[model samples]
Target chain A: MGCEEFELLLNGYIDGELKDPDLKRVEKHLAGCPPCQKLVRDYQRLKEVTAEMKFKNPPQEIWDSYWQRVFHRITRGVGWVFFLVGAVAVAGFAVYEFATDPAVEALQKLIVFAIFVGLGLLLISVIWERVKASKTDKYKEIER
Target chain B: MSLTEKEIVSKCQRGETEYYEQLVNKYKRSAYFYALGMVGSVEDALDLSQEAFIRAYRSIKRFKPQYQFKNWFFRILTNLCISHLRKKRRRRVEVSTEDKEGRTMPLPDDHFNPHLLLERKEIMRQLWKALSELGNKHREIILLRDFQGLSYKQIYEILEIPVGTVMSRLHQARSRLRVKMADFM
Candidate 1:
């Protein structure tokens, strides 16, 4: 194998992931290549040091409440969904009643209708802005 | 009695929400450590890992039984961390007000002092500093293989890449780390 090809197999060899025939081929190349031999030693040492470095364990209290926190999040999520839907439905009904009521003055009805329209337009604008921001957001597509 | 991951998932799918506690208890440490390694912050790691579990619970029906629960759950987690990192970089760029040829430049995270979490050994601190300096992809492969002790095949499953890709990426990642730790060597 040429140097490039040997270099490709070096990782596998160091990782013990190479099959016997490929391992033999790599060993044969390393025998005549001092640079590749040095590279292997360096890689092996790097791996050893990395393996020895472990993350510190978190406190037990975090573990104790971990599941409870997740449970609360799930419940809170469901609650928010219900709350938003109910709020929207109630607002829509109130607006419809106010707009259709014949007992109210003409100016009063016009002002109420205008207020609802303004609120509706504001909501749409905010939603549109959010959608546009998400489109341009660099983090939108992460590697799966 | 201990249940297999698949069995636990199936029970959760059957509307037994309580069964999920078993799954959470089983993999919470692994999930938290994986996130900590990826994001370099303990608080964010705990939040992200738990969020991943909640997401998994919501989407368990989409998970085919052939897939291992751990791999399926980890995919959700990695995607979340990657997204979080991008947002964090964007926030830093905004705060620094440094633009290089119309592209935003992320500021170094000088505030993220991992020494509080890690032991005071110089080598350990150097290892973490070197690991944090690595790009997300390189750091992820190293964390999975070295820190998490996952096999290449398991990485292939989680990352949805070929086994050859895992080996090559791991090689590149470790080579970069070797360069970073040249002072110690």
Candidate 2:
């Protein structure tokens, strides 16, 4: 191949991506061409520079943001769960305040607190259910 | 280098925004480097990356679910880089057969000391001076194939051109780069 032809195929040949016939032809030409040989060598070296170039990782927070973004998305789903539980708990508190007097039992406050804890756990469970409910592939197809 | 192309597209089309970020973060460095390499500015790289992501997000709807995600992402990035380069109207010197000696590839400047980093930063000032100095067609082909590691077929796919065009452009691009880097050799 002359300098012009060799110049056109030099890169493809260096990358080992030329068609078979084209490859052999380029190889045959390179066997006797000084400029083409030099061209091939230079392309190889430049490819090396590219290959050797360092791979820099993005910042750690980017990864964190990846999961955090996912988690935050889940959090919004959980928010409704919390809202429901908080509402029930508030209602229970209001009922207790208006219904029997506080002096009814020594353990009354403790029982009420325990009920609130249960209510909170129920809220979390509900959130988990909602997340599980939407975990289907069909819903996964939906974007925010 | 990434999830199989189909899987990526399906995941994205399925409204997998977070899954798409994997694509972003995966190629972020290359996208960033290409932008930085071509535009010779970090600000441009940042802008280009954002633009690439936004563009990718918007047009992803048109992407066939059967295509490769990396290739598709690269298509967006390279085009953005090209467009970004065009809008700014920069020039790259045609790399010709020149004395390409002693252009030692230092460890990438990411590891340099603050002072060296400054020097390295300035290095970009003249670095793209070589590549940027090339003609427009030569510039795009070279940057896409060499710096971007795109296959001829992939280049054709991305650019929507014939494979023959990819090969010729690649050859010209590499020749030009060799000429530009000739001084360093």
**RMSD per prediction, one decimal?**
5.1, 16.2
DockQ for every model, please: 0.40, 0.11
Candidate 2 chain A: worst-modelled 10 consecutive residues by lDDT:
A133-142
Model 1 docking grade: acceptable
lDDT of each: 0.84, 0.65
Model 2: per-residue lDDT, tens digit, B78-135?
7887786664432121211334694433222221122211233333333355555677
Where model 1 places Cα greater than 4 Å from the true spot, the runs are A30-34, A87-111, A122-144, B97-107, B111-114
Question: On a 0 to 100 scale, what is the lDDT of residue A72 in model 1?
Answer: 86
The TM-score of predicted model 2 comes to 0.59
**Whose DockQ is greatest here?**
1
State the lDDT of candidate 1 residue by residue for A1-144, as single tens digits: 578777768988887889989999998999999989988898887778777776778888989999999888877988999999999999889878877889988899888778878998999999999999875665553565
Chain B, candidate 1: TM-score: 0.91
Query: Which docking band does candidate 2 fall into?
Result: incorrect
